[model samples]
Target: MAAKKASGSGSKAAKTTRAIAIDAPPLDAWSDLIGHDRLIAGLSAAIQQGRLGGSLLFVGPSGVGKTSAAVLLTQTLLCERSSPEQMAPCNTCPACVQVRAGTHPDFIQVSKPDDKTLIPLELLIGPVDARLQEGFCHDVHLRPMQAKRKVAILHDADFLNEEGANCLLKTLEEPPANALIILIGSSEQRQLPTIRSRCQVLRFQAPTGEHGRQLLRKQLQWSATEDDELQVDSVSDEALDAAIELSAGDMHVAIRLVRGGGDKIREALWNQLDAPVPDPVAIARLINGHLDSISKDVPKRRAALRDVFSIAVQHYRRQLRNDAKSGEYDPATHRRLDRTLRTFREIDRSANLGTLVDCYAADLTLATTGDRGAIG
Candidate 1:
């Protein structure tokens, strides 16, 4: 059985991230990558100067380009340079080709187990950790193995519980000059202070609905031919809208929602217009649709909804914490966001679903419309 985990929006929705496309072009091919332009530029500059930190923490909402950006940076760092302006791979090169195929000598990717479980102490030691810390470590010590830098990427980095985190921390604290570690966590604060302290943090945000829509179109280019009534443009709007909403400002979430039977949200809508089952305008209605629409006769629906809210709360809290770092959303929005979250916390503890949902949703809508942030 696949490990079921709660996603960032706090939804326990299942995710189906296919094996990365080998033929996909490396970093530089992604120039106008909608949101997080600043992050790209910063990473670009650091690599160009050879000024990148040994250990980096890529933290942000779930879907923004944290993992993708890390992949790109690795490509740039190893690329034989034509110019400093671009540090990622020139995909045509030999090394770049291997990376695209996921067979590069000096690169490794680490994630959780099949149980959708956290990284246990043992897995992090002998097989996964030793391979990177010792084997790859020794190789990179001499010189770049085809590529200039030896790279290790840890995804869902927050899953490294106390023992696992401790092991990685030891390596990160005094990393070899030949090594570069990228830790991609769902949220900044969610990462342990011990881990967060050692690495330079780079934040990623969810790409806009407009940007995500374009990506989906390009990938799933199913045009309406002479024989078919179905068209790519027609199907995409609903998919994109659901993606954007489900992601809750995380690109990863948006993409996942599109994949894991998330397209169901589109069909769930018309019935929801008056009844408001799937797409609830109010918080209570959303909760009702989410938890009540369950038919598999299991706890999956409720658990998934719980997970979604957890992630959403975490994101809202993050916005409030670093008010200065992110200027796009002002302080007022942060305060409003905070109030909404506090209400969520209150609801999370309650057993009575109906009252809790109704109260929280009404409160948030009221807060959003007012200047002083009062829940009417």
Candidate 2:
């Protein structure tokens, strides 16, 4: 059968502009990984004992290094100088170097495009004209050119549509010899039962408290090393603490707060919410401007708005705490928090961002003014 070229130029999500860009450490730089010490140790032992399964599922919060850990494991499996018993990658070897560079022949990684809501079917199997002739499923079965094993990492497994998941079932059912398939998702509950049942599940927790602080510190150090203008000493402890609290243990959010002027945005949001009248129109404009500054892409804007909602939730929760300390209850504050949360969840499902923002702002106004009306 002759293969036909895929039609149209493929689409991609717009690149988000960050105040300071922080790249994940190279795959072979295992020491750079944070907050999964026990998981890593257990995996290393499993590798040494030859008990590691061919198909594995890593379920965890976003930005917690699940994908990074998968890449490191791939490096270990393919490293030229390391035996399985050693479970370590010699970063200097050809295999390790290629894996670190993302040029290794036996390593395959696929994730949902930022613009799209799900992992497209064509990514798993081949495009319509060449089913199984190309893409990840076909590539995973090919003979390894350098390493003894082929490793395929499917990221964003949470976004796999029914068709895509079904296409992957056969490969999961009978994987090629010496091949490893790893799926990374937010949670096992987000996965289809058939898909989850086929793989060994490893759960990961979001780093919190001291672990969260350490992660942020490490990121700052990395940023300092990469950009001569950035000095770790310049960032105040107060800023770090604020970022940690706002981020709630998600490193990606923490990074944005510390490096992306998110702290200032949060402060602005708080000030607006604290206004005597709490103008919904003004609040909506402030948030819309912040979202626009993040990206023109709707998905990115929606995500940023969700973060804004999180900040508002925190603000009201603090008010509630203060109310408790003063031996008084403010129903308005409690209602405002509830409305903010509802709007946050709606960000994903609502198509019209402007309307969502407008409604959200009005709801907050109503909640704050103690108006007896439908909120959000």
Which is the leading candidate under lDDT? 2
Reference-based TM-score of each model: 0.60, 0.77
- Residue 346 lDDT (model 1): 42
lDDT of each: 0.55, 0.74
Alpha carbon deviation, residue 300, candidate 2 (Å) = 6.4
Using alpha carbons, what is the TM-score of model 1?
0.60
The whole-model C-alpha lDDT of candidate 2 against the native structure comes to: 0.74
Task: State the lDDT of candidate 1 residue by residue for 1-376, as single tens digits.
Answer: 2122111211100011112342222345547354666777787777678788889998877545566677776666666654435653577776666655655666655666545447655444434533332322223233444655677777778677776787777767777788788888877876898999999998766655676676545433422236644355666577676656655665444544454455454344223322312233544564566566653433454344544454445545554557657645555445445654554334323334555555545545444422334322
What lDDT does candidate 1 reach at residue 23? Answer: 25
Best by TM-score: 2
lDDT of 1 at 1: 20
Looking at candidate 1, what is the lDDT of residue 134? 31
Against the true structure, candidate 2 reaches a TM-score of: 0.77
Give per-candidate clash totals: 13, 0
In angstroms, give how far residue 209 of model 1 lies from its true place: 5.4
Model 2: CA > 4 A from native: 1-23, 27-31, 221-230, 271-279, 292-303, 316-352, 363-376
